[model samples]
Target: MKLSDYAKSQGISYRTAWHWWKQGLLKGHQLPNGTIIIDVDSSNHIRETACIYVRVPSVEDQDDLDRQANRLTEIALAKGYGVKRVVKEVASGLNDHRKQLISLLKNADYTVLMIANKDHLTLFGSDYLIILLDQLGKKVEIIEDINNQSEDLVPEFMAALRIFSQKIYGKSMTKLQVSHLLSEFQKQFAPEEH
Candidate 1:
């Protein structure tokens, strides 16, 4: 189809479609006379459109977030995935109300979600999200998975305990009390050394 027709079919501006083509995101070519053609009938065209997601724990990590997004974009392009959009957020992985992440999950325009790490999506419940995305006919590409490192568990557990303690006891629980509780909980549940 013509580029204009493809743009109209996708309900996007001609300039946006043109930019996608210029960026090598659209599978198409231009003729000598300047007419652009798009291969809308390709079997895996829509399935290859990817949305890159990157997140940082705080606003202070803005540079790290940018680096993550850039790295993910490079990976996606190298894998021949069409870069549809890049969503960046400065929120803790334990945060459940990340608006950008939620919006991206809801949007069906992209078939793949690319991230530098699994925890970039969430520190907890990430497996559930991956399973849900798979059931929805979508894919998640993790560039580097350091999730299995035992050292990462302590901080995540502390954060989770802090949040739960705050919710259960409101704002009245002291840091000392939370720490004591965490120690007791660990003593009861920690695996025994052989």
Candidate 2:
């Protein structure tokens, strides 16, 4: 169906539909001949998934942070989360503080929360994660795996080992090694965290 037709069927204006497409809320595919096709199923998937938000630095160097935000948005969408509001570096990390991340942590509604790294944790550490986990207790599951693998298993395994290795060995491991070990000891770390 044409964009106008789809918009009419949904009782919304075509302009609104175009806005969603631009925001990545609605997806469109271009045909070989140059016409675009909108996948209603995928669009419906977007409607169903939970909102995934990103917080980044709003400095003159927003290019890199924008790319990072997009990467994380893709990961969250793949895991079946919707792309909701993006609270950019609206939160500052000055003087070892993260008011925005903390506010997000306090709210704790998202299915998953993806952060950059330890610097993020240093500003907002395990204590912050635990605080959200405790408040969200049983409402949602929290996973802290940061392995940028193409497969789900790798991320799951890495998350497990991240918790296990830290608990057992009290040491940090690289994402690549964690991904490898996760594949090696899949059964050993099948148990869910929290």
- Per lDDT, the best of the predicted structures is 1
lDDT of each: 0.79, 0.49
- Model 1: CA > 4 A from native: 1-47, 145-194
- If scored against the real structure, what TM-score would every candidate get? 0.62, 0.39
Q: Name the weakest run of 10 consecutive residues (lDDT summed) in model 2.
A: 49-58
* TM-score: model 1 vs. ground truth: 0.62
- The C-alpha stretches of model 2 lying farther than 4 A from their native spots are 1-61, 90-97, 134-194
Per-residue lDDT, model 1, residue 73, is 75
Task: Write model 2 residue lDDT over 1-194, tens digit each, in one string.
Answer: 56666565554456655666667766776578855556777444333323333333324335645665666555655654544433445222322455655566566345445544433333335566546554665122223335622332333334556657767767666656666776677668668779
How large is the C-alpha RMSD of every model relative to the true structure?
5.9, 13.0
